[model samples]
Target: MENHEDVDIVIVGAGLAGLTTALALHRLGLRSLVLESSESLRTTGFALTIWTNAWRALDAVGIGDSLRLKSTQMKGFKIASPDTGLFTSEQALDKDGKFKGYESRCVRRKDLLEALVDELPPSTVRYSSKVANIEELDRFKLVHLADGSILKAKVLIGCDGVKSVVAKWLGLGAPVRVGRSAIRGLVEFPNGSGLDPMFHVNFGGGVRFGFVPVDEKSVYWFFTFTPSQVPSYEEDWKENPMKMKQFILSRINKMPQHAQDVVEKTSLSSISIAPLKFRLPWNILFGNIVKDNVTVAGDALHPMTPDIGQGGCSSLEDSVVLGRCLGEAFLNKSNEEDDEFERIKKGLEKYGKERRWRSFSLISVAYCVGFIQESKGILMTYFRKAWFSSYTPSAFLKMANYDCGNLVS
Candidate 1:
């Protein structure tokens, strides 16, 4: 390895969590080296549903307004069964009575990532640098990159996704599969899809189909089902794009005419599959999620099922919380090189204390919701129709009520 370069903090993985952390730290006047495995920034993952809390978090680190300009404001969520066009329940996106006035938006992931990157200094992100190994020392963590360079930092924040090397190094176990898979894509209607601007979902045949009008010209859609075998990686789609495409077509072909139209027009190049995986909530609650100055964030910390659309939202939340904790730690101490290590330990501990129970409870709820929706039993179907439609919206509202607090930077 080349001679090691030391910094105060090193954030692994330049995805949503990593980029947010870097920007948050910068706002706090702290510089970080964000190491990304990909040769360049990710421009994939067509679009994501960002709820009210996420908008606040984005605003905390600066960029909420920019994203707002690029997104189609989602006012409500409609849930119903595909067979019957009748709606079960509709949750309005607002803060009143039981709900907070947090307007959810669906924005393209690539646009958001690019926005986050643009706010950072030119040298903030290092591309083509993957973490091959992590070795923890008494006062510092040594991050070994694939390019034979070493990054030594007083604090190591692992945002490296579900298959995280940093988490493995910290003794956290592998992510648990939720026994389901998703095929998602973005359909372009350069001439406008002529659909109402809202997020909608239909459940039937043990599958969940969802669509959100990201904008007038494009709509984001997904089909989630319990696959016979969950693919280990994104590339393991068992490549016959046509086969996967047809399988998706068969599943959603009978959905609403609008839904069917979106499915049929799914971009073959954009259609992608993913095996849903999550970390055990108990592991985060009772296990070693934090070790001294080394801790994990985002998927590295809590990879929950995306049924509630909170996986990325919670990951983005982590950056704000982690940044605040670290800022307080640094603000409380001197820049004296001697005690910098202790400051990081304190910061990470505070972050762990703040995040543990919140993430655990959310993960449990997400897993339960997924189980409820995916159940094939007639009783379960009745329960879902009678209960889920009414209860879930309130639960999500309670979740949005959470404020990660201001970044104060």
Candidate 2:
């Protein structure tokens, strides 16, 4: 009703998208309350291999220089077949030649999130405040937290992630599992890692194994298996995190010793295991991604398979575009606060139109890539060897070419 406390904006997650959106709004002197469900900021995820497009987004919001110092730039990239111990192809990933030196960085996800939050003022995020219900009103949206407090906001932004409650409330379907499960972990070497600071990936009959150096002392490694060998693993791994580590190691033991070592040194505490999931375009086409002043970003919008590593990068792009739209709308107000809500709704519509196609296309591409990489068979194997070897710089260049537009005045 009219009894709830009001805020200019309410962000329903403290993740990459929410924080970036908040930072973008801050540039225009707009403040938001970020509600995170957990008791504290999430530090569970492993390192991220952020691409140049994402770095561009960071630069737009003013954190590129700070993060660059903490990360290692990938100069080279390689793909190999573990089943045959035969290499497919190897080349420099830096954009010096056709790539134009558009490099990417592998940084700890926690560090990136913390850095984003640090740019905001104290207590911008309210931890332990989970959303239990959301209501749409005539001029505003109501956010009902699990803690029994109700908040009203002129605009509601959802960064709640793949299994997004906001998306659910808006009738968006659950994230679709593309029949692959992944185990990710961070391995640390006290004396410093011996592996090269380059991107390395190995393909198996129906699996994918990869590792990237996050820093001199640690590496983030991940393995994706098709059809998920250990059924019911989602619950089984929850019984004990070590069990998850064992499951990953068991699969990696037969690989080359170096790949084995990456898993062996991986700590049980740093491991994250889950089925790969993506939301289909039909979901976006048929469902309502935005209505009035309510909208979603990040995984809440396009939950893609990591096959192309575009999931997080796309989300960062979303924040930039969304913030620009909202900022521009907020800045050029013709008149009173009474029409501010209308301007916000128009901004949300603009954001949705700008993002809906791009995100759905990315989701489709990543899903197709995942299917090809994880399928088993002689033909598929042969195709991978041939296709990947011919995978040109244009493939990456095409993906990295787009700009998310800078933050509005």
TM-score of candidate 1 versus the correct structure, residues matched by position: 0.93
State in Å the error of residue 252, model 1: 2.9
Compared with the true structure, what per-residue lDDT tens digits does model 1 show for residues 165-214?
Answer: 88898889899888888889999987899887767887656788889999
Where is model 1 more than 4 Å wrong at Cα? 85-88, 94-97, 229-239, 334-338
Model 2 residue pairs with clashes: 95-100, 95-101, 96-101
lDDT of 2 by residue, 1-409 (tens): 4468888889989999999999988877888899999988996778878887899999999998999999888886777665654445677755447667576778888999999999998868999999999987777778998878999888888999997888888788888888888888898889888777777777656777889988888899888886457777777778877777777667656666776788887877777777788898888776789988888999999998887777888889999998898886778777566478778878888998989888888888777766777777888878876775346334544676678878863
Error of 1 at 305 (Å): 0.7
| Angstrom error at residue 197, model 1 | 1.8
**What C-alpha lDDT do the candidate models reach, one value each?**
0.83, 0.81
Per-residue lDDT for 174 in model 1?
Answer: 91
- The clash count of every prediction, one per candidate, is 4, 3
Model 2: lowest-lDDT 10 consecutive positions = 388-397
lDDT of 1 at 230: 36
